[model samples]
Target: RAYRMTETRGIIHRRVQSIIFVLIATACFLAVSVLLVFAPLLGRLAEAHLEWIKPYMGTITIWRYIIASTVIVIGLFSVHIWLPAGKRRFVSIIPGIVFTLVAWLVGS
Candidate 1:
């Protein structure tokens, strides 16, 4: 009984650690995405004097392009998981992909 309990405890600990890691990763990704999305506005605000923002200004444009592409890819993949599994369900993502591509092109 004691051995079983210890094994269960170990399994639980591993699961908890995995969940923590996923949560941290998710938070970091969200933070980066949010920052990239608002980077232009932030750059404008910091244009006058903020030295730190200057270095990132050029990189932010690249980040915006990468972030937008990442979002579109993720959205397309998500459609499979979100909808009932069927050949027709995959077709649903086409409109979303089209819209995303249009928005990304226009924004850039």
Candidate 2:
């Protein structure tokens, strides 16, 4: 009984750690995406418009992009993390690469 309890505790601990790790990683990716999206938009706005537009656009456009990107990353990685261990690597990496390529193509 004691051994079983200890094993369960270890499993619980591992799960908690993994969840925290995922959250941090998701946050980081979201931040990076937000910065990436924000800089170009701000630049365009600056070039075509005035400085006054900065504050107005920052909240509406920048925040929305940050939230949306975060959600997308979370959605994709959730599927990756939830799948069985054997299939997870394939599931996570393949879709990621495909999506990245499509994004680059469309952007270019």
Candidate 3:
């Protein structure tokens, strides 16, 4: 049966790991969504309290892009490492992660 296959592959024994991964993924998704929802409000607050940064909005936007890209890379790397049935070395997965990010960037 399908259960036997999963058991043999050690997936059944990793219920806790799977749950943790799902929880973390959900948290990350919710965090991003909440950030998006409040971004305008936050921007207004920032502009009101920090007038000196108004002229540098372009530079701040570039930094935001860099930070967002870094978060995406880390999220992709975590998916590559944690979603599989067995252990994976970080170095072994870097190339695939990089390729995936590049493909995503190009596609977008």
Taking the candidates one at a time, how many backbone clashes does each contain? Answer: 0, 0, 0
Q: Decide which is better by lDDT, 2 or 3.
A: 3
Q: What's each prediction's TM-score?
A: 0.43, 0.37, 0.59
lDDT of each: 0.61, 0.60, 0.70
The superposed Cα distance between candidate 3 and the true structure at residue 24, in angstroms, equals 1.5
Which 10-residue window of candidate 1 scores lowest in summed lDDT?
Answer: 1-10
Cα error of candidate 3 at position 59, Å: 3.9
Which of 1 and 3 is the better model by TM-score? 3
Candidate 3: the clashing residue pairs are none
Model 3: lDDT equals 0.70
After the best TM-score superposition of candidate 3, give how far the Cα of residue 41 lies from its true spot, in angstroms.
6.7
| Per-residue C-alpha lDDT of model 2 across residues 63-105, encoded as one tens digit per residue | 6666766666665565455422333454546666468647955
Ordering by lDDT: 3, 1, 2
Q: Is candidate 1 or candidate 2 better by TM-score?
A: 1
Specify the poorest-scoring 10-residue window by lDDT in model 3.
Answer: 1-10
Off by over 4 Å in 1: 1-37, 87-108
